[model samples]
Structures are given as C-alpha cells and as structure tokens.
Target: MASIVFAPADLVVATSDDIKVRFAGADLAAELPAHVQAPPGAVGVRVMVSGVRGPETMQRDSGFESARLAWYQQRQDGGPAREGSAPTMPGMLVLERVGALLRDDVGTECPSVAGQVGGDGTEWKGSWTYLPHPPEAARTL
Candidate 1:
C-alpha cells in the first residue's frame, strides 16, 4: 500500500467548506498499487491523523493540537479523447469537513476519511494517516 504523510505545515485549514492538503504521492497512482492508483479504477483510500492533544492540554502539554480532515471520492467525466489516448483520470475529491487546528476540539468535526472507487473502476485500498511532526530541538550555540 502506498502511504502519504502530511506535515503540520502541509495542511491548510481553510473556511468551513474548504481544506487543503499538500502531501507526497497524491499523484503517484502509477507507482502505487491498483487500490491506491490515481486512475479511475482503484480501491478505497483511508485518511487519519495522529498526535492529537486535547484543547485543555494545549497550553499545558508541549504536544501538537488536535486536528481533523474529512473527504469523499467522486468520479468526473474526462470527456472524449483520441481512440489511442489514455483514459481520463478522475478529478473529484469532496471534503466533508475540516477540523479547526487552533481549537481545542478539532477532533469533534474531523473524522477519518475513506474513499472508495468512484464508479465501476477497480481500486487499490490503503491507509492515509496524518500524524503530527515531532518538535524540533533547540540549538545550543
């Protein structure tokens, strides 16, 4: 199964209806297994997060805060192409909700996201877990 990691900086918590995530391998379908392929026929995709600290512990604990990101898979028509051309890749990823990173209760809204094949396409099912980055140590110069 192909895996992608989203660092704290790579996640974007936009407005209520928008959330952006920039991680490696989003377009690595060719390299991933059939389930995780970027093509139309692929298996389910799972998205999750780690290193979540409760809102009350945000100030007391030196760990990262809680955060969530939800999404659904969809199929879009690629339109007509040359007979010898490649099939159009699906271009639909519907976000259900984005947790507030700044809030103590980010986990309240964000749920684990799992995406299955959009239509009759085959799929390569895999996990997409998002864990918090380790804090950098201070330099003692």
Candidate 2:
C-alpha cells in the first residue's frame, strides 16, 4: 500500500473519470523562485489523472493501471501548459501498478487506489482512499 499526503488547504476535485489536484497559491509562492511569475488565478502545478475506470470501486484495477496521468504548469496567461514531452525523455507519467483495495471504514468499504506514477527521475507513489459522498441532507447541514 502507498500513502499520499495533502495539505488541508489543497483543492482536490475528483469525478468518476478523473482526479485533479491543484497546488495552493501560498505554497507555490514559497516554492517558486522570485523570478517566476505565476499567472493570475492559476496555480503553479496541477496534477491530473484521466481515463480512469472504476475509480469509485475496486472492480476494475486493471483498467485503472492503464489510466492516463499528466501534469501541467500554469502559463503566464493563466492557462495550462503541458510539461516535458521531448522525444528522448520519458513520458510525464509512467505507471507502476501495485494493485487496488477496498478499505473497511467502520464497516463501510471504501475504494482505495495505489500506484507509482512518473518517469525519468520524478515519481509519485501514493494511495488514495475515496469515501462515498454524503447524502443531500448531510450536505445541507
């Protein structure tokens, strides 16, 4: 199993087909050099996972292994610019599928996705556990 950590202020948007993690602006400012100019309303780094199947369940781990992963950098104009795709360099995302699991959370089983992704000296190894969404009433509270 792998572990992924996110700051409390990080924004994570997940759907059935994709997951996006946008770095916090304050974190970016601290990490980036003073000469680096971040566009307005855009984060410095964004990690995106797409083409994922069975993300809400563990019935299709094989398909998840083949999911597409990519990262983007914000342009000077607040748009995403794809990073590092030279012919000699490996692709931005290289999957090393470790497997998937269903975690027992107080008797409720939740989907857990674990894998190693990246290439050419950069890699992110982590597992993401997804809890079911709350009911409408719960959300309104």
Candidate 3:
C-alpha cells in the first residue's frame, strides 16, 4: 500500500488564478473554481498579506518601527497574549482575485514579499505577495 504523509498545516499554501497565498491550509474543495484542480501552479498576477492585526508596518526608518519590532518579537518568542481586554475578532482583510492552475509541480515552499494594503490606523491590510515566473501576471479570473 502507498503510504500518505501530510505536510505541516502552515506549510501548505494556496495558489489560484487571482491570488496566491500561504494560509493555514484551508480545504481547497470549496475554494477551488469549477475547472481548477490540485497541485496548482503560479499565476502571472500574485498577491500576499502580512499583519492581520491592524495595519502592517512599512519598512525603513520613516515610522511604524515599534509596531514592526513588536510583530517580529512575537514571531520569534511566540505571540504574546495581550494583557487588557482583547478586541473582538482580529484585524483582517479579505482579498479577491482570479484563479488559474499550473501544469508543472511548483515546490511546496513559495516565495513571498510583505506589502501594505490599507491606510486605516487599526488594521494592516497587506498582501503576502506571489511572483509568477512563467506566463506571468494575470488579472482577476
């Protein structure tokens, strides 16, 4: 019998025609399009997000240094529990994109960049970023 091994949940990422993501690895059946399939490849147009709580800190010395430092610390030391009353629900952004499938086996590990998506003070709406090497950059499907 062929043995099956599951990859780490966090290691499992999702790629579609519009947005490519490194999520907690959700059930793709519901998210997959009518004609899409498993082992999907990169799309020309790629997107990613970081910092789900409020907005992400921009790199450089301009500002938001403390917030960025805090996020980095949390990742290294494990997320610290907030002392005061935690806000109901976290800062989040919902992205919409097109879906396309890749024929070849793109490795499990995806390369991503941090980007900000909003101007709001309470949320960091940025994409985690995906880069398409082949046919390149696709619009929403």
Highest lDDT scorer? 3
Which 10-residue span in candidate 2 carries the lowest summed lDDT?
23-32
Give the range of the ten consecutive residues with the poorest summed lDDT in model 3. Answer: 24-33
TM-score of each: 0.18, 0.22, 0.21
What number of clashing residue pairs does each candidate have, in the order they appear?
11, 0, 25
lDDT of 1 by residue, 1-141 (tens): 223434464453332212232222232122224443244543232343222223432332222111101111111233333223333212112222332221012232222233332122221112342222112231110
lDDT of 3 by residue, 30-88 (tens): 22222423346523223333232212223211244455556566666657633323222
Quote model 2's TM-score: 0.22
RMSD of every candidate to native, in Å, equals: 18.2, 16.3, 15.5
Which residue pairs in candidate 2 have backbone atoms (N, alpha carbon, C) closer than 3 angstroms, thus clashing? none
Can you give the lDDT of residue 84 in candidate 1?
A: 31
Query: Model 3 misses residue 23 by how many Å?
Result: 8.7
- Alpha carbon lDDT of residue 90, candidate 1? 24
Q: What's the residue-level lDDT of 81 in candidate 1?
A: 31
| Stretches > 4 Å off in candidate 3 | 1-44, 48-109, 121-124, 132-141
Off by more than 4 A, model 1: 1-5, 15-27, 30-52, 56-96, 99-141
Best by TM-score: 2
